[model samples]
Target: MAGLTLSQASRALGKSKSTLNRAIKTGRLSATRNEDGTFSINPAELYRAFPEPSRNTLPERPKEPDRTTVPDDLGSRISLLQQLLEREREAVADLKEDRDRWRQQATSLLANQEAAPAAPPLVKRHRWWPF
Candidate 1:
């Protein structure tokens, strides 16, 4: 069994590197690192991860295909998404409010700093201990 680098495996497997990484992360593919800190992959493992059928090994299925109909949960999903988006919008508004508050506080601090008089510098004391 020939081992391939992650890039080589992706090219040979016709999959992107991110796809391969996701495969490894999801336990779909097994990978190992080379001594050079590069990934070494088994082609067999890649194949097992994303198997391809040769022309001769193609499955024979019925010509008729089932029609795809949207599930009833789709409406609820859309509504949930809408609600999530509204929540996100509210969060953004809250963040903006917080940012404005912080900005005002920062401006006040800067103004106060400008209003305060400068203090005289303290003289440095010599240390006797040598640690």
Candidate 2:
């Protein structure tokens, strides 16, 4: 039969006084309008209405994560990769020059072999007439 004051409701229910006042103001909980314009709540009714106060709590703030990236490190890594690509390109060009030199010499030798004369063709001639 005890009518708890606003602060008492906050302590007993483990809620903020402002939160309880809001609930009462928002028509969620029944309260007694006092003679001096104050308010009171039935403790039993509150316990029955909210058996578990934990259920009414707002969600906790999430902990900040430790994940972060450095933009300067990424830029330096890209510069290193580009330098390696340019060196590989120079090596490929030098190998291509060596291959072209070998191909030209082979083409010259084949041309000389074909330019030498071939053996003359053999021919046979015979004639028979019954006129």
- Every model's TM-score: 0.42, 0.38
What is the C-alpha lDDT profile of model 2 across 1-131, one tens digit per residue?
76999888789878888888888888888899899887879987777666666665544434448844445555587899999999999999999999999999999999998998986887755557644
Candidate 1 deviant stretches above 4 angstroms: 1-70, 129-131
Clashes of each: 0, 0
Taking the tens digit of each residue's C-alpha lDDT, what string does model 1 give over 13-110?
67789998888888778888778987788877878877864622434334446844444465577799999999999999999999999999999999
The C-alpha lDDT values of all candidates are 0.80, 0.80
lDDT of 2 at 60: 41
Q: Best-fitting candidate, measured by lDDT?
A: 2
Candidate 2: residue 105 lDDT (0-100) = 96
**How does model 2 score by TM-score?**
0.38
TM-score of 1: 0.42
Which residue pairs overlap in candidate 1's backbone? none
For residue 100, give model 2's deviation from the true position in Å: 66
Name model 2 segments beyond 4 Å from true. 53-131
